[model samples]
Target: MTHILAKYLVDARYEDLPANVRKEGVRTLMNWVGVAVGGSREDPVKRSIAALRPFSGPPQASLLGRTERFDIMNAAFINGVSSHIFDYDDTHLKTIIHPAGPVASAILAFSEYHPVSGKDFLNALVLGVETECRIGNAVYPNHYDVGWHITGTCGVFGSAAAIGKLLGLSEQRMVWALGLAASQPVGLRESFGSMNKSFNPGRAATNGIFAALLAAQDYTSSDGMIEAKRGWANTISTKQDYREITEGLGQRYESLLNTYKPFACGIVIHPAIDAAIQLRNQYHLTPDMIARVDLRVHPLVIELTGKKTPQIGLEGKFSIYHSVAVALIDGAAGEKQYSDQAVRDPRTVALREKVTATIDPAIQPQQVDMTITLKDGRKLHKFIEHAIGSQEVPMTDQQLETKFEGLTDGILSQAATRVLMDRCWQVESLPSAAAIAQAAVPQG
Candidate 1:
């Protein structure tokens, strides 16, 4: 009668998550808040918040973008969407799961309605992140290759489990919640460049909450939904090591492995970002000096981030060529690097056209190698063993703070941003979850 999934959920809520996990969980939340606020001005986020204004629920949670009495579900939907609008949210490359948006959005919605403590909110986040990374690891080559956005699709179950833990669901009930979540998974890579990209995480937060609520009401789905023959495995997996999901569930903290995004682009291009940054700094290279740029990268990155003619910010965010060009010209890659101006810059666009990538099958998705040939016929080679913000080289507290402040500077003033960052750092000791949520998404 022991359900490993339920045990992990309950234990994570009450005990298993350590101090570091809680601290990191809140940090992830803080970074997510930054992206959501920054995305407030994004056309995609604006359009959806505007669209949902007329479909208000109960004024449960504050939509970060606008001043409206949005329901908890709508609040989650909008917040989740905005978080990924710029593709700046944190990533767990090992699982290929976009962790922050879905988990933070779901927790924000829950916090508005319930008066749970920040420590408990952190617990739910840790649990949710675990579920997210686990599923992503299990699917591996097969599920993601089939064109499913794992962050949005599998993220629902993680969001549901986290919400369930926060609501204090029983062990059996948490299992039911997972089943309910499994039945409604949705997301497609085909929708990458459109508004639907944000839609995936939005639905994940809303539906995940619904699944948990329904399960608490004794809603039942197939008992073995996760590992069942015709369950997630059969429906979503291929060439996947299903065993990876359960192997380190209780022993290791998966959220710790999550990578923070420095550039508002696909994680696959992160190595390219590192390499570009290296080249930019080493030579203090100017765009005019670079005659032609060539990138030797993993085949997976080539497939995912090889957009050659990006016309918009979102499209540029997914394009390696554009990102590399901007980093080289600007000397730094920031949220602005993905702005319309940056994306549509004639200089950047022209430089991007000169940059070409060749596939290297040996270089895995988690890594990238670059060999840049400058106009002077000088070759600059940079091997980014790991992206800067990844677990291999995690962002220090000071760095994460700088990222939060820099990203939220104009949006959230110094005083407000400091308060939010401080609260997240010691979330385990906060008064209540509502305090954390309010500090994050203030009414403007």
Candidate 2:
């Protein structure tokens, strides 16, 4: 299985990608850059830089949204952390893996160290996302249910495959890279709602680069590390569907399945938040007008975001109660809605207390049944079959631009943000892929 995947990655070319898949790759890059720049000044990023800057080697690549540069590996790690800090990166709905954080983060950083064409970058990005998401599909609920953060664990393969492609590794070397990546899986579900949660993707990006670099040097490992009896699949999961990894190598593109988050929280809570925001906008409702906000959601929503009272912004992101409350009170759930100040606001707190959720097995994770009780003895019911950001209902390009603008509002000048957005859209045409990173940093 590992050998077959490596060969596929080695032989895949930009010209083979379908038009829609390539377009989605561009969109993924755009969303990732927006979030990374927006989250550059976040506390976790700041602390990470402060802690690692001293140990970092000579600067080889730019860190998105900041002036400082670091070694390619460190740049990948930091940018990966920034992209995912707000829980706002793109997601593969089936695996719940934020594909770009681990894959794009590594390859973009590597682009700085070694100049690659935009086409090559995009191709690598697609392959990387495909590699991880397929592996993720293979071990999903079992790997995830066992407390492994699937993104961090599966993401390393993405990083390795992407970097390996750029490095022009032989099929054997690519297999070795995968083997090395298998030895290092970072992240646990226990780290959710904390700074450490962001650390997973960061480390995955770094580890993949490390694996690929070593493999390029002929670093050796068991070739069947991914599918052996005691390998990653069997060791980490009870069920291993190797077919998911090799069945449709070039024919199926998982990158096209990528979905961006409209709200800055876990994907499972999106339906409820979408329902709340729609009802709030439709009725022009205020906290005083809302008697109670009731949600009948998928079991995963409460299992993942059941926090009744979230003390901080990150914690609030994992709370369906808080997400719905803010969506109803503010009519939107942007970064501001999930901020420390927002979570602690008296009005938000009071409204969140009135929000309650019940799990329904029949309700799909992307569907929600909501009822809003009013102070005037009126009840408003909304049943969301699919959330706005789901694959069934994707965010429009204009909506994505609006989301980009909102995230970068204070962090970057309108001019700079626009330039970055343009570069991201024009990535495939750019002479050097590093131009995106250069555009991401604020000018003096």
Candidate 3:
């Protein structure tokens, strides 16, 4: 399995990618930059930079949305951390892995150290996402059920494959890179709702770059590190499907299936939030008008986001109670809705207590059954088949642009944001991929 995957990654070329897949690659890049730049000033990102600055080597890459530059490895780590701070990065729904944080963060940072064409960058981006998601597919659910954060664990493979591609590694060297990546898996499900959650992807990016660099120097490792009896799959998961990794290498692109979040929370809670927003807008409902809110959703919704009361913004992102409350009160669930102030707002808290969720085995993760009973004895019901951001109902390009603008509003001037967005869309035509990073930084 390892040999086949390495050979495929080595042979894959930009000219072979389908147009839609290439387009999604740009979309992935665009969304990732928006979130990274928007989150650059968050406490976690600031703290990370401050802690790493003294130890960092020569500045070789720009940290998106901030003026400070760091060495490629440090830049990749911080950018990966920034992109996921809001939990708004692109998610491959199948594995719930935020693909770009690990792949894009590494390659974009490396692009500065070694100039790469826009086409090559996008190709690396697509292939990286494909690599991780497929590996994730091989050991999902069971791997995830065991408390391993699949993104951080599987994401290293993505980072290795992407940076290794950019480094022009031969098949043998690429196999060694994969073997090295197999030895390092960061992140735990317990880290969710805390600063550590963001740390996972950041560390994955750094680890991947480390693995690829060592391989470039002809570092050695067990060739079957991923498929041996005690390898990553067998050791980390109860089930392994090697076919998912080796089958349909170039033909099936997981990158195309990536989805951006309309709401900045766990993907499982999206349906409830979408229902709340729609019902709120439809009836002009206010806190006083709502009597009791009831929800019947997949068991995972409660298992993942059952926080009855969230004290901080990050915790709020993991609470369905808070998500529904804010969506009803604000008619939207952007970054502000998850802030500490918003989470603790009397109005939000008061309404959040009124929201109750019941697990229903029949309800799919993306579906929601909701009931809103008004103070006046009026009852409203909404059943969402698929949330707005689900692949079934994707956010439009205009909506993506709007989301980008919202995230970058005060961080980057309107002019700079527009230029950055244009650069993302036209990334394929650009001579150098570094222009996107340059546009992401704030201008005086």
Q: Write model 2 residue lDDT over 140-223, tens digit each, in one string.
A: 989998899999999999999999999999999999999999999999998999999999999999999999999999999898
Most lDDT-accurate candidate: 3
* Candidate 2 C-alpha RMSD relative to the actual structure: 0.8
Q: What's the CA error at residue 52 for candidate 1, in Å?
A: 1.7
lDDT of each: 0.80, 0.93, 0.95
Q: Which residue runs does candidate 1 get wrong by more than 4 Å?
A: 239-242, 441-444
Model 2 regions lying over 4 Å from their true place: none
**Of 2 and 3, the candidate ranking higher by lDDT:** 3
Deviating ranges (above 4 Å) for candidate 3: none
TM-score of every model versus the real structure: 0.95, 0.99, 0.99
Clash pairs, candidate 1, are 291-375
lDDT of 1 by residue, 78-136 (tens): 88998888888888877678887887898877787888787778778888888877877
